[model samples]
Target chain A: MSAPRAEAVVIGASAGALEALSAILPALPARFPLPVMVVVHIPPDRRSLLAELFQAKCRVIVMEAEDKEPISPGTVYFAPADYHLLIEHDRTLSLSSDEPVLFSRPSIDVLFESAADAYGDALVAIVLTGANDDGAKGMRAVVEAGGRALVQTPESAFASAMPRAAIDLCPVARVMPLAAIAAYLLEV
Target chain B: MNGDPGSEKVEDIEIRLLLEAIYSQYHYDFRSYAMASIKRRLRQAREHLGFPTFSAMQESLLRDPALLPRLLGYLTVQVSEMFRDPSYFRALREKVVPHLRTYPSLKVWVAGCSTGEELYSLAILFREEGLEERTIFYATDINQDALHAAEAGIFGVDRIPLFTENHRKSGGKSSLSDYYQAAYGRVAFDKTLRRNVVFSDHSLVTDAVFGEMQLISCRNVMIYFDRALQDRALGLFRDSLARKGFLGLGAKESLRFSKHADAFADFVREERIYQRRFE
Candidate 1:
């Protein structure tokens, strides 16, 4: 049997991730059953245009998470700039001012690790284009937690280090180009 | 383990032992912290305390109860600024307070409030909103030292500029400086602003709701907890909020994926303001 119904899709990316995000968001249809959470490495002290930017391209309702606001399907939640976004077990969002991890606060590792803990086998963790190896251990944690893990192929990534690092560290379930990620998400 | 720049084997072992010893000796439960952050904090503690080994750090904490405060300074994340996301306060001023003022009296809880900055900021807001006269504010934290500091209502003068700017941006009515008196490079907040406020030790993870409240602002605290603990805290908040009560979280926090997602509806999504859903 197919694994448990996917509750959420989590993407952890850095560096040139926005390029891939543009391609990935529009791929998921409006009626996509699961919520999508994106963790993009952003500079501290800067505001993010991610929610506004992605909303225009994606069919889903895209909004920045307010504290205590519940997760809903057919919606997209982008990690706030500079804050570590996490999922509480009840699926609420929690943001941290804890010092940056791997020199990044909206760290892929933090999001991926937390999502894995919260959703476990129902999560789909994707690693995308980035310079650092931030998502490696977190992706491993996801796999160990019986969640699905996907990495963007290095050839399709602007900065391949992140996806390659994850590939080296764990046996990812899928490695696809940015164009194929959302398609794969739908098929799965 | 020697000269291996990347292998965390030895470092991890030391951190585990240190955390275990701290828990066994002092009953402080930091054993569940993420390894990387805990490792960094412990390193900072060791260096700050001039201990050559993690064992020395552990010995120092075990020997001197006084050292617990300093160790806590290292372990607890203390990065808070007044009126942190300015517009969140603005939304509170514009949308929430008008409703709050309708009630004859109010009870507000600021959970996971670190170092009193946020608590004081709220006190200022309530005073400006004219709700301070009938409000009872409870500011709770897990760190005793932070609770003590919060009760004292003192802060660095250097922070006043930014806090003042934030207050203004949040649509503050009067001069932000009026809320605190600056003396000799330190600021003591107005005592009257905090007259109805209480600072206490409360752990959202392990503790039950103490009382029902019209408003609860648990900002930036749940980020440290695992999902299970976060859910427990949410349950506490959900249980604690009176019917049609309000909840505020840090800018990045949300209730979307939570079991209680349907329990509250957004009043201002960007500002993270929410009202309890009608049962």
Candidate 2:
């Protein structure tokens, strides 16, 4: 059987997200074909340093997603702090200030469900090290849309609850280490 | 946010129908809002309101007039923080106010004023800057409930701390406490702060331009709109502003791609403030 292909990737994480994401974001080649959209739980009060911090390390272009901006390949888009990121059918990025889901503003499930609606089977979703189960519903959405889902193994994660929940909700998601997930991105 | 959108799924069809229903029955023209936001809110509405689907929601909405306001609550996001993005307010106080002072009397429109957080922030800023006496503030929103709340200017005391901190960061000249009295877990802003303020029921989506203004502060409200609706609202602002008047938008919003981009130039690029252009 042939390996499934994906056009874009969406990642969700909360606690321990920085270290877990650092391993994968910096490893992608400059010419990476797919765009990576990431949602990390950060306090709404502080301006995020994720884009600036990752831009210096990642070979691929890294920046905070702006509303109505078209999805561009060879870039990684981080959800701006405190706004839920969504993908439109036209592939333009949209941000929402609607009530937070699961006490999270930039919700993983919001991004994943919208991306699934936009990309369907051509999407790839990842759930990484976190303390909360924000990404579990998103994982299920991706899986139900026939998109591939990768969950960081609970034992291998810095915080296991999030990844463990993703597994419980969407068992078909590939259980892998962060290294393998980075490898999977390179395969694109 | 206006060209024909790509609506393909059964859910999309249902949503389009629901929006149409909303417009015809309630006169709320959400048909042109950004599809992604509409869809997101629809999902939330279905879950929270216990509608099995958009189809069911639409049916309930058509028959029950009482359901419209409840649904509009979900459709329009009313939650906002006072003095949000302090830098934006700081830039307004430092950069934009200098130009406004040139005019003997000023008009400032707070489009989509929501629950008055932004309106109160601006009112306090103007008052501190000594522009309050000369300024007439117009605050407008589509939601009547929100307009009433904006008019009342009372907020839970729990929100005051962050508001106070933000006010401080925005180069507040006077203490935030000077403007309001706290009691019973709530603070009622001195009504005198709103003495020059006018709160109105207005929808940028359907309403026409009203009154020429020296400045218009319509922030994050545009992020809810599609690209086309944004252009329409921008056009209205362009028409409404006096020559060389200013416009302030949300932190993430910009005029770079709007059809009315030529009507304004970046005043404080970092703060998304723009100045009306001759052309």
Candidate 3:
């Protein structure tokens, strides 16, 4: 039997995420085939500089996701600070400010669940370091939709709560250290 | 309401039927809204309105006319603030206001004006710019309650601090306190500020343009719409705008993907403000 291949990648992180992201994003080559979508918890009132900061260091193009914009390959899209990022059936991006879920506007669970619905089995979801459990239910959703799920090993994470919660919900998810995650992504 | 394994599919169908019923009965077209948020709001409504399922909620909504306002309340009210994005307003004041000053008389349309925060912000801005006497503002929204609240111009006293800070950041020439009077935990913005303003019921999804506008600020409203509906609203804005008029969208909203993109030129790209093309 052949293994399923991923068409796109969605990642979620929170507290102490910038360090974890720097380790992963800069390692990807400019020619990476799939689009990457990310959600990192940020203050609702402030403008985010995540895209510009990552784009300066990473080989791949990075941009803040815009509403109704078409997803592009070889580009990384970060969710805007105050809105929930969603993936439409047509593979376009959308933003919503209806209400915050779990005390966060750009909720990891919201993005992960929506992407799971959009990409189904072709999706690859990753949960990284965070102080909260926002991504646990979302990781489970991704796994249930036949998508692959990966978590940073709790011991290696700067903040272990998020990965531990995800592991509790999705025990079968492949756990990798920060350094190995980049290599595994390159292989995929 | 039971969490059965496949209840997600069942709930989706029920939501569609409920939206269809609301449209057919109320003539408020929400059927084309972005589905994810709509589903979330419907779930919230179903739970808060004490219905076992969306079907029961739809049945009650159809039978009781009084339920419409409560349901609309859930579907429409979003958290908003005066000068929510200070930088966008600063761009408007610093960059866009110069071009707007050229017109002898101006008409600014604040579509989906919510509870009038943006409208008041612009009104105070115009007053400070010494253009208040020459401008007429149209503040519009689909929610009757919101429109009424906008007309009243009363905001909680607790919100004054942030509003004051935002106004300062947007280059206010006068004190924000100069525009309102406080009483009993609320502030009633001076009535004279809205003397030249009109608060009306308008829906971007169904309403037609009532007048040509020099500048139309419709921020964050279209994020709820689907592609076709967004294009339709953009078409209305394009038609309503006078030659070389301006349109300001929310920070997250953009015209790049719209069919009407060709009609606009980036006025302040970072701020999401666009100018209507001469051709």
Candidate 4:
């Protein structure tokens, strides 16, 4: 009947994700309470500029996730280019170079599933614009773990396959435009 | 009040018991590893090894002594390459080698040297710097199969081009082709490159310091360890390094938060190279 209280947010995006992220990340004020973990598909061979680029526009702290590093509030952590980012039981960030899932190294499914395990009902997961179905199973896991799942309306997304996949996989909490999703995040 | 019944799943309990069985029976302690990755790997081992669950895997492991290595293969991560992260090697060549050239002799330890790619890279680097004649390299890893592969010094031929490019980017003094001969779709590196190298089975989780060294290049190995295990490995490096000796880690690892952080000073901060400092 009411919105679930969230302690953290997990976001996944692929193609056309940078533009979508740039739109949403700036909407959250500096006093945002929840820690945000993100996995955006990037080329494995090169370094990532997502953290640097996002930090300049977002009011909250933004950085790449590091192994065994603790998660902190008001900070955004992007999964490193080649490593699968996971959340430990102790609520710290960890990175792994295990075999890729769904042909992606920093797989959205991996991050979402792990965050669901660690945060349970206190987690909020978002599936954004992407070209593939990497986040479908992960959003399913979030809903199963008593967490909330939000999908960008497929028609509103630049690349609709990912959000459409999430919508098909799970009965998500909301399907909204990018601006409305950002506004919902602010409410949390 | 001591235990939360809802939070602990049967799968979680079985995994903890499996890790305990592994440590108690085989003396390989993965009990303290970060649980999330461990869980993922164990699930993988379960599915691949044809076991129904972690409990089934543990039962077979405790009864069969021969299953340890196969399970260890699953437990240890073996992803590596020749000149992986070329910038780190470039920094080693341009920044660290100058200091090493001053020493008459050098001992270099490639801790967690998976398949010897890193050891060979350093061996070739020393040879290029004209320090190979005066240096001895200790290449160590926990996986015996990987150690054997390292000693063999052969890699698929397909990997050579990337390795060559990486070598060139690392300020290589000679053609990478000069170091290996290609045959049968594989490249067999020159045995002379390992003339002063010793490949050994060592576990950073349980092993002790074996020798004092002028340099230790242990990149990307600590990412698998928990905070305490990482500290233990860093402590070994601290104790084994000669005063002012250099230590290099994976791009993501840093000593800023380690318990042994005080023993090392940042040498090449951008490259994650640290030098042992004497009090």
**Superior candidate under DockQ, 2 versus 4:** 4
Tell me the lDDT of model 4 at B178. Answer: 95
TM-score of predicted chain A against the true chain A, for each candidate: 0.96, 0.98, 0.98, 0.97
Ordered list by DockQ, greatest first: 4, 2, 3, 1
Tens digits of per-residue lDDT, candidate 2, B1-279, equal 234576367788888899999899889999878787788888888999999999999999999999988888888856998999999999999999998889999999999999999999999999988899999999999998888899999999999999999999999999999999999999999999899998999999999997789999998898889899999999999999999999999888888768899889999998899999975
Best by DockQ: 4
Q: Which ten residues in a row have the lowest lDDT in candidate 2 chain B?
A: B1-10
Work out the TM-score per prediction: 0.66, 0.96, 0.92, 0.96
Listing every candidate in turn, what is its Cα RMSD in Å to the true structure after a full C-alpha superposition? 7.6, 2.1, 3.4, 1.7
lDDT of 2 at B204: 94
Q: What is the C-alpha lDDT profile of model 4 across A57-171, one tens digit per residue? A: 9999999998888999989999999899999878899888788999998999999988998898899999999999999999999999999999999998989999999999996
Better of 1 and 3 by TM-score: 3
lDDT of 1 by residue, B1-279 (tens): 224766434555677788888788877777655344455567768998899989777777778889887888888847788888888999999999989988998999999787888898898899888898899999988898888888888889998888888888899999988877889999998888778988888877556786879999988776565555667778888889988999998777677646777888998897778888888
Fnat of candidate 1? 0.41
Model 2: residue B105 alpha-carbon error in angstroms: 0.7
Instruction: Show model 4 residue runs off by greater than 4 Å.
Output: A1-4, B1-6
| Model 3: how far residue A170 lies from native, Å | 3.8
Compute the DockQ of candidate 2: 0.71
